[model samples]
Target: MVRAAVVPAIGAPLEVTDIELPEPGPGQVRVRLAAAGVCHSDLSLSDGTMNVPLPAVLGHEGAGTVVAVGDGVAHVAPGDPVVLNWAPSCGSCHLCALGEVWLCVNALSGSGEVYARRADDGTDLYPGLNVAAFAEETVVPASCVLPMPAGIPLTDAAVLGCAVLTGYGAVHHSAKVRPGETMAVFGVGGVGLATLQSARIAGAERIIAVDVSPEKEELARRAGATDFLLASGTTPREIRGLTDKQGVDVAVECAGRAVSIRAAWDSTRRGGRTTVVGIGGKDQQVAFNGLELFHWGRTLSGCVFGNSNPSEDIPVLAEHVRSGRLDLDSLVTERITLEQIPEAFGNMIAGKGGRALVVF
Candidate 1:
């Protein structure tokens, strides 16, 4: 039996218990997790903000060592370190055909498949978001396992699975932030912190970090923000004030709320780009008049999984980490055991700290 944190049902409390993991079948790999990052997405899955099968092991950002592999699994072998890719693109999908693999239509199909069984009652268990990295060990499809980038510490690499990639992609791919350009990151959680670092790496002349928590000001500054502002009704105005009466050239919203998204858009300069990286519920709506849309000439887009191709991007990020251009350690505020995952989620809800890592 392998220990895992399971979400028994949508909107249910997480249960840390043992589950029976099956040997890898064809085209699958078994991994012994070393670490997993407690991401906000896990909170969304546990509370029903996002839809996934019930009674699932609910962690996706992680790194581990390969234990076993089934037939046709050739990319990694036993004893090799690996990172869990929560969203592995299906190469033959329409989006993949067009080179937009991040939006691949079949990425989450595996989330519905049963991969484990509850040890106590024999109830079948599903892998949440495909990788199910919250457990001590997990069995995942071969495509969901990627070799860890060389030179990165195995445990710290957990954030690379989700937060780091998403943040880096939002700045480099989604927003195409240029050096010497003004950039603003709304929210300073794990992903937001990554976004700030990425903006700094991209050489944004003025980096503004916004959040509801004033206590995070120093943390934000540490992660590369030149300025930090408490989020409020006049946040857009404050951001504009910092940009010489003009808003930032690029604004990325990591808060995932309608109000925050609108603020991000409003805080961007005319003809600038605003990328939404936060995942909010459908009920959180933001409205804009047709005239403003026509007149602003601003581009607003949604990003998924950082619009990142993990196979290609991880190496680049790893190089950045090696060169000291990126600080993965700075992204982590607390190191915890698997049992403290629920507490990590509570901190995320309260808008406290940076990433909380579950060290196995």
Candidate 2:
């Protein structure tokens, strides 16, 4: 039996309980989790902001050591330190064939499938987002596991699976931000900070970080933002002011709120790009003038996992982490145990810190 934080249903408090993890099936690998990042998406899954079936183990950003591999598994071996890929692409999919693996059609195809079970009743448990890293042990497709370099700390590497990939991908891939260009990032959370750091790595001339929390300013600046502003009604104006009224070349929405989404669109220069990296609630809506779509010639695009191909991008990010170019260490503010998930999530909802990891 392995212990896990299980969400029995929508609106239910997370229950820490002993669970049974089955042996990995063909092409699958079993991971003994070293750390799992407490992400907003996990909170969303728990609170119903993001929809997933109930009685699921909720965590996607994780790093661990491989304990076992099933038939046909050859990429990794036992005791290998690795990060989990929540959205693993099946190489044969049309999107994958087109080299757009981030949009792989097979991603999330196993949503309601079971890999763990209730120890007491033997009821099947769903693996949320297919990775299920909230548990002490998780079984995932071999494609979901990526080997980590020897020097990268597993605890910090846990976030590279999601937060780093998403934010970095937004700037490096989705936005294709060029050197000397201007960039504005909305929100100063993990992904937002990663976006900030990526923009800095990309050599953006001016980087602006916006958030409602004043405490985040220091961290934002540390992540490479040249200027930090309190998000408010006039934030777009403030961003424009910083960009000489031209607005930023690339504006990214990481706050996952309708207001911030609108602000991101409004803060981009004409013919510039706006990338929405935040996963907002389904009902939330943002409005824009119909004519601006044509008149502004701006590109408003949504990013999933930063449009990253984990197999290829994770290694590059790991190297960045190794060279001190990407600051994953600074992003980690707190480390707790699985039992403290509720409190950790409370702090996240309260806008308490950067990235909190559940260290096993």
Candidate 3:
């Protein structure tokens, strides 16, 4: 038996309980999870903000060691450090074949029962996304597990699976913000900070960090933001001033709110790139003038899985962390235990901790 956090219902903290760990089925691997990052998406899943099935295991970003492999699993061995990727690529899919594996629609269309009991009495619990890393041990398809470099710490590598990948991918892959260009990022949380630092690594000349909370500015500045915009009633004007009155070359939306998306859109120069990485509610909508939209020629794009080809990008990110170019350690603000996931969600709701990691 292994410990797992189960959210039996919506709007609740995960109940840590012992779950049976059986041998892997065909094409599956059982991973002994070492560390899991508490992501905003997990919190959103638990709070019913993100549409997810109940009695679900809530974790997608994690790092662990493979202990057992089922049939046809030759890519990984019995003891390889791997990062759990939620967006697993099906190599033969149309998106995958186009070198856009991050947009693998075939792999994501499932009921998310990657791990469950096989008996009639077993409750069918859903695994949020694909890789449910909230459990001490999880069984998943070999495709969902990506091998990481041995030297990187499991805790640090855990976040790279999602937060780091999304932010870095948005900047480097999607927008392709060149060196000496200006970019403004809204929301300075874990992913936001990663975007901030990624812009720095990409040689972005000016990184303007925007947040509703003033306290996050200090950390954002340290991460690489050249200026901070504490969004008051007049954030658009203030941001305009920071960008030489022409708005930034690139503006990224990370807050997952409709207003922030609008802010990010309006804060960019005409014909500039506006990248949206935040996952907002289904009911939310942002309206823009059709005439302005046509005239601006502003390229607005939505990024999932950071436009990353995980097999290739994860290793590159790991190498950056190893070389001390990208600062993964600085993004970790608090470390919690398995039992503290409930409070960790509360802290995230309150907009307190940057990244709350669960060290197993």
Between candidates 2 and 3, the one scoring higher on TM-score is 2
Distance from true location, Cα of 360 in model 1, Å: 0.4
Local error of candidate 3 at 72, Å? 1.5
Off by over 4 Å in 3: 109-111, 117-121
Report lDDT per candidate: 0.95, 0.91, 0.85
Candidates 1 and 2 compared by TM-score, better number: 1
Q: Write the per-residue lDDT of candidate 1 for residues 19-49, one digit (tens) a residue.
A: 9999999999999999999999999999899
Number of the predicted model whose TM-score against the real structure is largest: 1
- What tens-digit string does per-residue lDDT give for candidate 2 at 69-157? 99999989999999999998888988899999999989887767877889989878999999999989999989889998768988789
lDDT of 3 by residue, 181-228 (tens): 999999888899999989999999999999888889888998999999
Candidate 2, residue 100: lDDT = 93
Off by over 4 Å in 1: none
Question: Superposing all C-alpha atoms, what RMSD in Å does each candidate have to the true structure?
Answer: 0.7, 1.2, 1.9
Query: Model 3: C-alpha RMSD to truth?
Result: 1.9
* Positional deviation of residue 313's Cα in model 2 after best superposition, in angstroms: 0.4
Candidates 1 and 3, the one with greater TM-score: 1
Estimate candidate 2's alpha-carbon lDDT, on a 0 to 1 scale: 0.91
Clashing pairs in 3: none
